[model samples]
Target chain A: MNYNWNWGVLFEEQYLNWLISGFGWTISVALSAWCIAIVIGSLVGVGKTVPNKIVRGICATYVEIFRNVPLLVQMFIWYFAVPEMLPEDWGRWMKRDLPNPEFVTAVVALGLYTASRIAEQVRAGIETVPPGLSAAATAHGLSTAQTYRYVLLPISFRIIVPPLTSEFLTVFKNSSLALTIGLLELTAQSQQIAEYTFQGFEAFTAATVIYVCIALVATILMQVLEKYTRIPGYVGKEA
Target chain B: MTDFDFNVIWSSLPFLWQGLQLSLLLTLLSIIGGIVLGTLLALARLSGIAPLAIVAATYVNLIRSVPLILVIFWFYFLVPLALGRPIGGFYSALIAFVLFEAAYYSEIMRAGIQSVKRGQVHAGQSTGLSYWQIQRYVVLPQAFRNMVPILVTQGIILFQDTSLVFVVSLRDFMTASSIVARTEGRLVEMYLFAALVYFVICFSGSMLVRSLKSRMAT
Candidate 1:
């Protein structure tokens, strides 16, 4: 094992800039996708629990279709086929005029994919809340909507904060798949550095460290959130 | 837009099947390897030996925190040089997946092991069973049975993740489909077909898991 070791190459201005911007993109994409997942997933999740069988069926179907497919394939469909499926002018606009198409496609693909998973979590969280609470709220003359808004969601959200943390970390890790569509996030940037410097070992090692750092910080922050929000008597049970 | 061509895909089935075989091979190999190593790590974490527990915990945490694709790259590039020899992409990716999945499997198995009744171990100890005997005869059988559904779920995830090996230019199903798509200029057809194949397999696999779960519940 006589290969040259050049750990210092990562600090070069060119590689450093790539890593920084890539890191920025990765964080931005993951954060934006997390927002989308939580918002849509919550709605779809609540929809799944509604009494109307049709709404529940539709929401379940959405989760199945999105969750069953591979993220890479979904990304490909979004980046390539989706644009072509639109009307000609809109399709052309998307392909030619849309700003940061790869980033947009990546975010949309990752968001919708993750939303299905989060929807399951959200559904589990909602279902985990005691039935008597909603019953009591109804008995107090609160409408179903108000009961959920004031009573059910608050508690369920607290219960789900831990699993949501895992999903949050997952969104960040899955962002690395965006490189398949040419968004130069951290993984892609590392690959580019490796290609230029022929130092795949160091480049990937650095990227791995960065990912571990970011994920650990997110985990710690989520742990703190979980600890503070944890209902003393209700912790540690699986939903 | 061009008419969708069924003929190209039909004619390419043999090549596609070869790719599928490789994908399955990777999945099967890695699942076995991961479970074997994962059980060891899980045991180490539960072994009540501080250094072993700390080392296992760190390894699992470090592996779990990073994107698996990065691990594939690290193994693909680093291991060969460390061994003072070059290895092929497929072998490197296989090793990478095994090592990466072990962390996740360990976590699942750890939870499963903990779920077993503590009294059962006490009972075995009272019968004069050695510690290793208690684990082997009393704890692990129950734990593994409890974890089968979860292990299957993880296996499904492993199948989906094997697509990531396309990054290494492995001739897995995804890479093969993309190759055909590029050469034949049937990008949409190829990709959509590929997605459908994945969806059908995974969706049915999950359905089976759901039924198995219900059976377990009953």
Candidate 2:
């Protein structure tokens, strides 16, 4: 069989547009879900840190449910089953009232699943803030909440920045899973492009390059962020 | 008025059993293929040759960064388009899944190799064992023992990851559930049945890995 290589196929306009649009969808999912992850993970992390039995139990159960289940199954449940369980008008509202129900379900599923994992990271980060700082703040007569805001949180966020970057990469990679529910993310778009051009290698190689670039950019930005927050030898510079 | 009919489970027993057989075969074949390929890839990454190392690293990283669904799609959709050879769905899915699982396992094994003490190598050399023999005798046994837990954890994760095959429309447990749901119009029961299937296989695998880990530590 004489095989022809088609490296130049993606330079064509239609294929280029397919790649660009797929990325637009992927980045939107990553950013939207990142917002949700930050908020939800922080809350659950704080709850995990709380001394109260009920609060810790609630946080643990949340983590267990979201963490143990496969994200694809969670997406399936969110897209198909959860809507059916909603109140009649509510289900209709979710199905019809939302623009891009696929996007919403993808965002919610990816966000919730990733948030559980991040909650564990956040809890570890928050816990790593030296106990002395918060104790000192409380001794200085700050309220408990004030102690957390003034002393604990800032340190923890800085400590967690590198790991937080990793979580971001994972969320970005996992956003590809959304394509199964028919979100036109990078994976889905690459498939569609390949279908049209039969340039499978070119489309997939482009997608791989895109993912590597994102991960590389993330690593670079994370390094910059680490520098901005630098207190030399603060955590002994190991991380 | 509302109860899960155990009888629906009984009637659907044959279908679920079929899914179980397929799921077991898929997992087993992929695990075997993955173990062999992943171990080699792991060794390749640790090999002294620069180009070989780069190739191994790139394979793992590229495969890992993309979703397994996409990998499966490549085989399921594009193989026919790209190659004149027509591969059946199950074997195609099996091949893709094995490749995907190998990337992660190989990554884990690479870490395992690095974690072995450098002194063990020198010691083995001093004892007059050849380099290949050193790896077989001194390095691999220790690395494998140290990595048993992680290998098993990866196994469980890979087992869960097998569910991604549904994207390629393979009739694994998840797809079987959908089929049962369609024919019997019992979505809830079918899913519950599927979940149970997953739980039993994964839970047992976890326990075995745990126990094996404890045994190896001794």
Candidate 3:
């Protein structure tokens, strides 16, 4: 079978508009969810490593529940099922006050889920440090809080940079599930445009390329960081 | 926040039951299909055949790097267009989940299979078994036993990901809860319940897998 290809369709004004508008929503969702992930994951990751037994248990519970479940299911639970249980006024507030509840719900769910994995990454990073490092900081006039801030966290963050970058990519891809709630992000926009234009392959191909490019750039950046941050023994392992 | 709604729970029982069926069916078929495809891909990679390894690696990296939803949508939207064939919604989704899951499982199996040591293969030669026989009798059985925990872990992941089929309007438990939420107008309650279901399913599956791993170790 023979087929004709239309490269012009991609650069047309209408398709460009869709791409621009869709990217705006996509970036907003990704950034917001990423922020949430950073906050929750940092806290829980530290919590898991804390001396307090209760805090460690709580963090473990959180990680197990969220990390093992699917992002799509979590998004659904946030978008469709959760509001019904809210108090009447609060429920109405969630439905009406949120400018785009779809975006908000997606961010919250995806962020929380990704945060669990990030928590593990953070913990792994922290544990990778020598045990006496924190003690040395404490003995050398660093407070308990200062010990982590000054000595533990900085080194751990550098060490875990590669896995942390992978976590970010995972979160980025997962943000597309927000489309199911009708947020009109990149994936949703492409699908909608494809439906309207009947150029399904073209629209999805663009989406695929964009995703691949973003991931490639992120992976390269991570490798560079790893090289620069090389802690002598760990450098040049060809990850 | 209002108290627990016993009435809603009682009324939604049958709907929840139906959703359970769909979730189970999707989870089982996807895991099985994934295992078959993943084994083939793993074998191809381990074969040390350059082209086959390249193809297998490409498949794993491409799918694993993308979002699961994109894979699902790719199958939903592009299958009929590419093949000129009509497929059912369930099968379309099964295909997507299988393809995605295979990428993960293949990687896991590849690691497990490779760690069997080169000496183990030569040892099989002393017994006079063919290469395929060695794989089936000596390699795969032990590999599969050790492979069970990873398989179980991947299985739990696939079970949870079955919710992605909801994007195409398949009434899985999560979708069913959303429909209930729309009618009831209680977002938090419905969602919390949905999360509860996911937590229970995944947590129990993981616990089972962990115990099985320990049992195997013994």
Per-residue alpha-carbon lDDT of model 3 for A1-239, expressed as tens digits? 12346666768898978977876777778778889998999899999998889999999999998876677767766775566557788888887897778878988998898889889989998998888898898789988788888998888887887777878777778888888878888888788877777766778788887778778887897788777886776434653
- Weakest 10 consecutive residues of candidate 3 chain A by summed lDDT: A1-10
Put down candidate 1 lDDT per residue, A53-88, tens digits, no spaces: 999999999998898889999999999887766778
CA error at residue A88 for candidate 1, angstroms: 1.2
For each candidate, the alpha-carbon lDDT, in order, equals 0.91, 0.80, 0.81
- Judged by DockQ cut-offs, the docking class of candidate 3 is medium
Top candidate on DockQ is 1
- Chain B TM-score for all candidates, comma-separated: 0.97, 0.90, 0.92
Give one digit per residue, the lDDT tens place, for model 3 in B9-60: 5688789778878988999988888988998899899898999999999998
The sequence of per-residue lDDT tens digits that candidate 1 reaches over residues B42-119 is: 999999999999999999999988887778878888789788887788889999999999999999999999999999
Q: In every candidate, what fraction of the native interface contacts is reproduced?
A: 0.69, 0.19, 0.65
Query: What's the TM-score of each model vs. the native?
Result: 0.96, 0.87, 0.89
Single out the weakest 10-residue window by summed lDDT for candidate 2 chain B.
B1-10
Ranking by DockQ: 1, 3, 2
**Cα TM-score of candidate 3:** 0.89
Compute the DockQ of candidate 3.
Answer: 0.50
lDDT of 2 at B2: 31
